[model samples]
Target: LETVGYTLVVNPKTCVVCMDRPREVAFELCGHFVCCAPCANSLGHGVTPARCPLCRADASHQRVMRRAASLHVATMADDHMHPPPPPPPRPPPPPLPRPPPLRPRARTTSLGPTPPPLPPPRP
Candidate 1:
């Protein structure tokens, strides 16, 4: 059997304040992770003094951490476990028809535009 892959491991302890999805969350200068782009943007934009929720470090200087691939898998698993109701059936795929054979367009402007005259040098 083929292995699915390792689930992304998010450390709750490492998460300072936000409990939102790890994938959507970003780390502040203080190393505190906040959920959602709005939250992160709000914190960074001066609405709230960015600070690490856990360490109380200055969040203003913190850089956002890119979510690791492993974290993505874990997030997917969590979503699957608590999925919302499925949407209505999608429309059927359109029928595939053979594309018309390529015909090359006639080449115009074979020599291209004439070069402009050079300007005299300044004294």
Candidate 2:
């Protein structure tokens, strides 16, 4: 005989507020897994201002419970299904060194030599 195990899956897209996996917690009203604690709190108390995190349905009278089975499944799924977080960014490469400026060439003409003037033309 062969044995197989079944697991519950939580859809992240269904919940708008949860940062972590939705399977970590379960909804009180709809019995559907939605978001984490922060999201649950935002929906108001399960009995008072009750609201569904995913569908925004009225959940004032529903009961909230911690789902151990679902949480276990989520943890296992997380371990095998998720990709490793990206590495931290590296520092930019050092700026390139600038080349030295070229020196001006010396002039060959003598500094004190005077130039010949034009002769006067006949009228």
Question: Across residues 1-123, which tens digit of lDDT does each residue of candidate 2 receive?
Answer: 123466545444233465443444454434455556556666674455666655555545443434565665344334433333456799999999998999999878777878799799989
Deviation in angstroms for 28 in model 2?
2.9
lDDT of 1 by residue, 52-71 (tens): 44444455554444556336
Clashing pairs in 2: none
Local lDDT at 49 for model 1: 72
Q: After best superposition, candidate 1 residue 43: deviation in angstroms?
A: 2.2
Please provide TM-scores, in order, for all candidate models, with all chains considered together. Answer: 0.30, 0.32
Ten residues in sequence with the least summed lDDT for candidate 2: 76-85
